[model samples]
Target: MVKTGISYSSLGSPDGTLPAPQEVARHAEQSGLDSLWASDHLATGAPFLESTVALAAAAGSTTRLEVGFGVLQLALRRLSWAAKQIGSLHALAPGRLHLGVGLGGVPADEWQAAGVPVAERARRTDAALRALPSLLTGRTTELPDLPGASVTLAPAVPVPPVWIGGGSPAALRRAATLGDGWLPAAITPEGVAEGLATLAELSGAAGRPVPRVTVTVFAALDGHLGGLSQDALVDVLHGQFGFPRELADAVAVSGPPELIAERIAAYAAAGAEHVVVCPIGGAWELQIELLGKARGLIA
Candidate 1:
């Protein structure tokens, strides 16, 4: 079955406020979401919780719902610190953690705040990905760049499946070579189909299995469900994300639950194994309940 999830770390509400992480998490689990995802950012220029902390809260509040970083900016922190955080979360959540890593899409000032050069993000992320396996498994791992320096985390837990985010060629290559899954956002069904085919070829070339696919959709249910219009969602996609207007209109999933389910099924037909809905309006709780109903229709 196609697993369905919701992104609770959204600032897309009409009033720019969100409920507590634990509350959203419990509600998602009760509402029948398979997982809950949180986006990571150091400085989003808006109200945003730290991803790790938010996921920790979610995980603590629910037993069945998987908690993940929709995409954590690995380069924003020292490799060791990143490993420590992942390891600690793994220890806490055990098999429930899904590690999603990426080079990030936040403003360059966030990178500057972390002392990470913008250009070095990809290199740092790749290095961090390479070193994570060892560090998280209690094996002595040499720190990246500091040859002699090494660290090992205790209470070692299995490294959660890593989903590499972004839809660029470089991202596809990274997912093919280093990730267990590929996560792309604001893309169309045809794009997902094409990306999966590319992933199969790239993974074969790398002598690795093809990665799983997950698509993060930005959406808002119409009527009494979530008070946001299709035009508003399209504008947010086109303006904030710089998607071409046409592409935004085609990709944005809005309107009633039936429409939402149909759009999600299209992605599933295109090869996505999972869909993470990041609802784009207020009435967050109602939107989540409605998303659950859509998931039921797909099931």
Candidate 2:
């Protein structure tokens, strides 16, 4: 049977407001989602939820569903600290944890906030990667105590799989070299193909085993297809992918159940070991029903 997952994009309803993270999480878990995924963004002209805190609340509520940081903004925050925090949370959820890292946020603002120079981003990113492993292991290993005394996350759990998120070659290379999983966003199939190639190439060069490929898709499950409409699809594409309206609607998977299953199967055929459904606007009940039905199809 094909593996599947679901995400709570936690997109605030039509109005600008943040919902309780725990509610979204509980919904994902009850809905039979393989994993719970959330995006990390720094108030990007919208109501963005804090990834770690939100996930922590989720961990407190669910025992089965896997909790994930769908793409923590490594460029914007202290990765070592983030790792520690995630390590602690993993204890709550145990091995059902996934760390998805990504380069996000405005370069100028993120760097300025952290007092890091823009030109030095690549160096910082590399350093973050280097520092993350120790923190995840809760080994008490030190790395200049990034932004503070180097410390491990509390309530440590076994190391969880790390998934690198980015559509770029460099990102895929990093995922191949260091990550246990590969997760970029759902954009064009061409992008997924390129990312996978880069991951394979880097893994070979590093003599590492191939990492799992995880794909993300935007979906609204209240309908029979758990799909979104062309207009709603455009909204998500613009907000999530920044894709132009026409292009976003053209590629998004939104329709009744049969059609939605077809879209998900496409991803699996393209080499996705796990497909995360990033749910659009809706309550947990409807969302869970959609995922449960989708899971049945995939199973």
lDDT values for all models: 0.88, 0.71
Distance from true location, Cα of 127 in model 2, Å: 1.6
Clash count list over all predictions: 0, 5
Query: Candidate 2: where are CA atoms >4 Å away?
Result: 107-111, 144-156, 189-194, 222-228, 239-241, 245-247, 282-284
Candidate 1 overall lDDT versus native:
0.88
lDDT of 1 at 105: 78
Model 2 clash number: 5
Best by TM-score: 1
- After superposition on all C-alphas, the RMSD of every candidate to the true structure, in Å, is 1.4, 3.0
What's model 2's overall lDDT? 0.71
| Residue pairs clashing, model 1 | none
For model 1, the superposed segments whose C-alpha errors exceed 4 Å read 223-226
